[model samples]
Every structure is written in structure tokens, then in C-alpha cells.
Target chain A: MPLIDEILDLAGYRREDLYVCLGCKICSSICVLNEIGIEANPRNFIINLIMEKEELRRDPLLKYCTGCYACTFFCPWEIKVPDMVRAARAALLPSHPFEQAFSSSLELFGRVYEPYLLFRLLPYFFRKGYLRLLVKGLPSFRLSLPKRVKTEGIFDREKK
Target chain B: MRYAYYPGCSLKGSAKGLDEGVKKVFSALGDELVEIPDWNCCGAFEFGEKERILALSQANIRKGREVSSEIIAPCPACLKNLREAADSSVSVLHPLEVFSEASFWDRLPMKRDLGGRPFTPYYGCILLRPREFALRVRDPMEEIITRLGGKVVSSQVKAQCCGGNLFFKELEVSERLAKKVWEGASGDIVTFCPLCHLVLKTFSEKGRRVFYLTDLILYVMGEREFL
Candidate 1:
């Protein structure tokens, strides 16, 4: 049991951290996404996670997070919204191709890479009316090389 | 003061000005910055596994440890990632602390007139948040700006996220958020983190220039053209 707790603790976003959520919704209201018209109801999501609702794991609204910890900063319980999002995102990654592609770029190049990000998200970028961005990034190979900083896997332990 | 420098991937590329600005500012302050030999990427992927990011950051910490006991990460994302992996053995610092240091105050020449309105100081999303990992220098940019004969332009989006993580993933939505940040800001937007700088600098229209807090330090020290 002690070892399991350590593994969970080390693996990030411990279950014990979720137990402190008081459902105050301070995180929800203070969320910067709300200002942008995205209803990032982080409180409900955390509550759903605590309740073990499988449906919340598939919620598309979860993808709207900017990874901004404004909610965590304002949360009374100190529950990290970004960590909770990360936990949810781990399960949600397969369904979210854009996110999955971006993470794959990180695994490959290790930066918030531009070229591959453009290549992978071409259709999405076109649909999003950002072809201008793709065309601009098209000419910039000089910028892409710096994104590939190899992070050698020193800590090889993997969570079961 | 001397520390190991981790010019995270963003600072190496799009935010290169910040990297140069930090070096110049530190040199001006008489602090020595040594780049960590073979420092790996401090993970900035929002959807990346927490363990993976921590492991990646830990690798950089090990590299940083080879250089100095204290590590300086100029970008807020890098600062957060490195500090998350760093234990009591190594201290991670951001450039904001330099503003609070007595050395900065003592060495600063008389306030140079940049001839401007109140500069809209942007701290971005995480530069001073999540409490435990944030830099201690609160409102330091405002003080520095005021001391340098500039006013602090108060805006609702001053500390908001500049659509940083979304800029890459959700482009239109990122633009909407960036639009809010640019609109909410006054004349020129002054930012602390590289992502905020990247998002704002590239997205801002009408020639509304974006300056990293370090760039402002360089400007006050008299290098007019940084773009």
C-alpha cells in the first residue's frame, strides 16, 4: 500500500489531491477561458472525476483548457486544475487527435514544434482559417531545428 | 550572483530576443549566467504526461546541477517545469527576482526617458501563480516601469493567459483569446514569459509592439531597436 501511494504520488496528480476539492466553483468563475466564452467548468469536471464518471473523460469541453492554472491559483482547496486536466487528458488523448499529434511532436522533437505541428494539423488548420499560419511556417526550417532538444530518458521507471 | 541558465527551446528560437535581453540585463547587473551544458528540453506540452514532463525536467535539472547550485530559467513555462523537478538541493529562479534584488536598484542609472504612456505589464498565466512554484516578486514590473519613468497601464487581462497553449492547438480560439489580451491591453503589451511574448508578438496587429520584461530592461539601458 505504501509503495502504491509512492508510485501514484510520483506519477503526478494523486487521487488524494482530488479528495480536497470542496466544489466551491471559484476555479470555474475565475477561469480565463470563461472570459473567452468557453465554459470551462473545472469544478464539475473535478467533481465528476471524484465520482468516477466515465462520461466526463470523453467530454469535448475538457479540450478547451488553455492549461492556464488561473483556476488552481484561485482554488480554495489548492487542487491543481492543470494536473487534473492532465490526468483526464491522458485518458482523453486517443480521441483528441490534435492533442495527440502535438504530444507526439514533443515525443519526437521535444519542443512546441512548428513545422510538424503544421504538417500534422494541416486539415485542422485549414478548417480553422489559419492557412496563413501554415504558409508562414512553411518557409521557416531554420526555426524548427531548435525545437529538437533530445531529453535523454534518465528516469526509466514507468507506472503500471 | 551566478546561476546556471536554461534557455528553454522557445527562448532559443521565437523568443530569442528574450534570451539576448536576459544576457544583456544580467551582465549590466554584474551577475554571471552560465548555460547548462547539454540541458534538455523542459517540457511545455500541455497534454504531455506529467511523469514524462517531470522526467524531462529532471534530466535538465541534472544537467543544470553540473553547472551551478542555482538555476535560472528565463521563460515562465521552463521555470515552472524545472522547479517542479528540483528539490531542496537546487534552487530555480526567474528574472523577476532580479528586479527585487538590491543589486538591480543600486546599479540602475537615473530613469531613462523612453517617452511613453503607462506600459501594460503582462505577467501571463503562470509566472506568479499556483502559489508554491511562483516567483516572489509581485508587481515588480510595475515598480520597475514606474521607476524608469514609465507608468503601469492597468488592464483586466494583465495577468491572463495570452492563449499560449491554444495558439498551437486551437488556432481560432487562440486568436480569440489573443484578441482579448491585445484589446484589453493599453498601448504596448509588456510580457514576462516567452509563450505570452510569442503569442502576443506574432498576433498583435496595428504595430502594437510586445516587449518582454527583459527587453524593457534593455530599452531603459538604451538599446532602442530590439525587433
Candidate 2:
């Protein structure tokens, strides 16, 4: 599928929105591409996608996106480039193993830890006085996560 | 007013000052901040690379579900992570947003000065585009800055990421970005996020003043009357 079409299907962005884009290259000019030594250009990517090209979606440059929304922020028309890319990513979700693992971990973390464990450990991490202050500032009751859920592999490598 | 507070990892460690400052202010505001129990790390900078949306959004939704009230995150990264998580069911707001609302604004004790200069308000990345939150702090921050003999200047660059986490992976890139942040500002940069504080502090070459919002608040509150 064409990247733009796939993204439009997911995000509901219209073709008229693309017509307003002037290709001024402002998005690329301010982009931190050189910092990472990648030639990723939002303008070119959008233009290619609009042209019904498939190669643009397969570009290795797409992987370099930090999803920081820098391009979207600088765009004069307020085009959501990050959202568009996010949609494209959703289409390609099955291919990325790491992302799948990470997402699974979020669900697992909530299921495994209970309120009692968090309450005891949380205070130790904060300053004694600050913890007391936190307790005082908070409401009188405790909130807990769900009791059980399937756990997954989010961490394959340990942090050094 | 009540909020579900997510005080990311740094608040317990290097950013303890933020925890102290927020507590004092929130107490004064007569607001209740309920910490989301059993909250895991927001996955910070690493999650973006691992799973752009799901990893970021799940932590937020999980916290949002645990707390009935809106989630008030003090850390800019945490706020950004949650907001970007793509979860629509729960509302995620910055602590400043809660503090700045008219109902709670009046409750906060506004002090005039710090070392005879005005207090400057820095809205780092996450809070910059959110007009409501930024506007809320403007008046009070300006009042405090003026009393301290300091001037408040808003910068387009204030919203830029501090590039701290990117440092380990890309040192030169982070440094260059940090330099741009420094060049874009006049006087000290005051921010609410701990990650921004750590990044700015690391990149600061000498004589460049960077302060966490809590530090300035504490100075003003400590110098004046207690809540």
C-alpha cells in the first residue's frame, strides 16, 4: 500500500490538507538530520507519499524518527507529520519485534505490582520528609492496579 | 481540586528539589495530589526507540485508569510521554496546569522577590504549546521574577528538548542542541521539568544560570510567608 494512503486510512488526513502544503522545506531545514547523519527529509517523504510511491515508505530514514514532533511543530500548516508516521508505523507493527516486546511489558508491569508493594517501595526512593509531604498532600486512600494479567518479554538486554 | 500525580524517577533522586517545591505549592493551593500506586517507570527516553506509541501510551493509560481524577505529571518527559501515548479516555495535565487554574491560582502564595530579582518562568518542551498552562504561570512567575530583580523573557527556543537523554547515544548532537537552547535565552532559564534541568545543568559552561521551577518557588516562599 502507498504510505500516504495507508496513513490517511488510519489518521483520516485528507488530500486537501496535502494541497495546502507548499513544500517550502522548512520542516527539513530545521530538522536535526545532520546530527544523526541521516538524510531524512519530511518534505520529500510527504511529497513521495503523495505521489503514490512505495519506496518512500521503505526508506531506512523512517526508522530514525524520534517522534519528537519537531517537524509538525515547525510546519506552517500545522500538519501532523508525527501522527502520519505513527499511522504508517501501526501498519508495519508486526515486523518490529522490539516494539512488540515493549508494549507487552507495560501491561505486565501493571498486573504484577500491587498497591502494597508500590507504597512501601515508593517512599524509600523519595526523601523521608518529601515522602511524608507527599502522603500529606495526597488523598486519604490508596489506588491499586489490577490483580492478574499476562506478562511478556520487554527486556531482552539489561541496562548497563 | 484533586489530581493523579506521577512523579517520575528523577523526583526521588537528582530532582528531589522539584518534589519539595511542588509539595509546598500544592499544599498551599489546597489541592490533593494522589500518587498513582504501583506506577512503573514511564520508560523515559528509551521507550521511544523501543515502541513509539504503545510503550509510551500504556504507562499513561495504566496510571490514568488507576486514578479517578486527572493525572498531574510534574516531569515534562512524563507529561509528554503520557500525552503522546494516544490514549483518549484519560486526561493528562501538567502540575502547573492544575496550579494555574483560576480556582487554585489564588490559593498559591505569590512572593515578590528572590535575592532582590524577579523569577523567570521556563516552560520547557511539553508545556510550551499548551497555551492554557503557560498563561497560568505567566502572571505569578512574572510577579515573583520582578520582585527578585530579575526579568522574564519568553523564548521560542524554551520549548526545545534539552537533549540530555540523547547525550549517551549522541553526545555531540546533544551538545549542539543544548548550545542552541543556551544561545536562544537571555538571563537564566527556569523550568519545571527535572530532565530539562539535568540537561541544561550538564551543558551549562559556567555563569549560565538554570533553575528548576521549584527552586525559585521555594526561594520566594521561604523568603516571604509560609502557606
Candidate 3:
């Protein structure tokens, strides 16, 4: 429960947001569960949370969320179901190995390379052809970097 | 009119055409986009996750507040994130929506050479799902396309996701998704999101051209004398 509070604190969302949610099942029905083949019944999870069902919070169903946000799109009430599930999973990360690994990788990728490569050098590399040639020569170094990184000027800015 | 502009990571990088076109189109309509200073990475991928909202969205908002006006975002993901972060408190409008509102659509000069081709309005995932904004773009886009002697084909796949997010994580899924959108349509895809342009262009096996909405605008603007 303390972990739940921590998640809530981090999310800055109130329980009232969840309470406003009506279990209409729109989210589950529209979900791409058939493609992913994972149980992502957002309505059921919300209901369980409302009932204080601690076991539901511990269920493996939370792992299936791709954060695609199909649920939030269809919600008539605009209830933030994905946010709720993310918070719940955040609280249980200690026991959730898969989630822990994923989070760790994300944080690690963001830290080690994103600052220098993505935020800084990538832009310079795109602008200066020599830098791109240099990086290309070092294939191993480039291959080791995160896939999401982008070079600045990949998008053209307005001319001054 | 002037507003704070958050072009997002993609606009600064791979989607330069979008940034250039939007600025040109809006400037022609007497609108100004003041880029926010000292902006940080938008946590582009993680904002939707509850754990990252405060760090991601709030940080953008705090920077946005420095501008003292509603933020006009060129990227749909950035707009969506900022909208979610502001709790809809501030008006987070797409540059196209702004241009359309300023009656820029009415002032659009006709196209000279359409090549008799139709362009599908590719809404991408974020922009299309938000029905209000999608509808807003449709009318203006239609008017512009029609004037260019080009047809605007309405396709279901137009609003589909371009697999931009999945591309890096799952190449197979990305290729399949891109093919779905490409194969599902009959003509070239026109998009507002740069990620969609890059993804569609990469996966297009038939050499289908994906035009950004801004690119089309610039093209039309270039041909204004013909109109």
C-alpha cells in the first residue's frame, strides 16, 4: 500500500480520476489484444482496484500493456485507465521482474547515450557530413547505441 | 497571432520539412511561432506511462508557462502530451489547426500542376484518433487538394498508425503495419506527423511517395501565381 502511495505521488493523479471511470468495457473491446494475445481487460482491472483487490494488482495481466493507449481514446469519461495500470505496475515493480528489467533498460538507454548521442552529437552529425561519415566508419560504436536516438536537423528548421 | 512552439524531437531531427513548411505556411498567414528556450527532451516515448508524466509533461508545461500563452505544437505526439499535461487547461493546437482558424485555407492559392494524382490524408495514430482535430484538417486539406486539381481520397487506413513506435522495438511489426497502411490505400499518403512520413517512406515497397501536410502547403504556396 505504501508503494501504491509512492506511485500515486509520482503520477500526480488522484484516486478520484479512477473513481469517475465507468466499467463500460469499451477499452477492452477496442484493444488489440487479439494481435498481442495478452489479457488487457482495462475494465476488469479498474473494478478490481476499486474493490481493493490486492491480488488483482499482483496479477501478471499488467505486463501485457504496450502503452498504446487505445483504452484512453475510447473512454467516454476520459478516465486515465492506462495511467492507473502504469502506476499499479510501478508499485509492484519490486516483484515484477519483467517490468523491472524493461524500466532499467529504458533508464539506462536514456542516461548513457541519449544525452550525448541523441540530444547533442546526433544533430551535429546530421549537419556536418564528416561526422556522419566518422560515425559510419565506427559501425560497432553506432550499432551499440539506442535505436530511438535522433540527430538534430533531421527535421529542417525555419531559415533565419 | 503568436504562440509558444514545441516542435518536439522529431521536428528538430528527421522531420525538417514539416518544421520548414509549417513555419512558412503560418508566417504567410501572419502567425508567429516563438520557440521555447531551454526546452529539454520531451520523454517522447514514456509520457503516456503514468510514471513519467510529471517528469515528462510537467517539465514541458513549466517551460511552456515561461512563454505566457497557449502552446502551438507541430508534432501530434507533443501536442497530445502537452494537452494531457495541461489537463486541457491550455489550448494545445496543431499548427494546421491554427492556420485553418486564421482563414489561411481560404487564402490558399490554387495548384498549377496536380499531375492528376490524389493524395491520401494520413492522420497517423495520434492526430486521426482525435476526431475533432482530424475533421478540422480534412475540410481545409480537401479545399487545398481540390484546388490543386488533385483528389483527396478518404481511406480508412489514412488514420491508422504508421508503426513509428514499433519500428525500433519490433521491425517485423513495423514493416507489417507500414505495409498494411500502404497496401490498404490506392494513392500517395499525405501526413502531418513526421514519424509517419519517415515510417511510410521506409516501408513503402512500391515507391509510394508520402507527403507531409506542410510539404503540400509549401508546394501549393510555390504555385500560388497559377491559382
Query: Tens-digit lDDT track for model 3 on A43-102?
Result: 887777766677666554465454456677788976656566666665665433222333
| Best first by DockQ, ranked | 1, 3, 2
How does model 2 score on DockQ?
A: 0.09
The C-alpha stretches of model 2 lying farther than 4 A from their native spots are A1-22, A29-40, A48-68, A82-160, B43-66, B84-90, B103-105, B110-112, B115-121, B129-149, B154-156, B223-227
Candidate 3 CAPRI classification by DockQ? incorrect
The lDDT, on a scale of 0 to 1, for candidate 3 is 0.60
Error of 2 at B64 (Å): 3.8
- Candidates sorted by lDDT, best first: 1, 3, 2
* TM match of model 3 to true structure: 0.69
TM-scores of the models, in the order given = 0.86, 0.64, 0.69
Q: Give the clashing residue pairs of candidate 1, or none.
A: none
Cα distance off (Å), candidate 2, residue B30: 2.4
lDDT for A24 (candidate 1): 83
lDDT of 2 by residue, A39-79 (tens): 77888777876886777667543555544556666788867
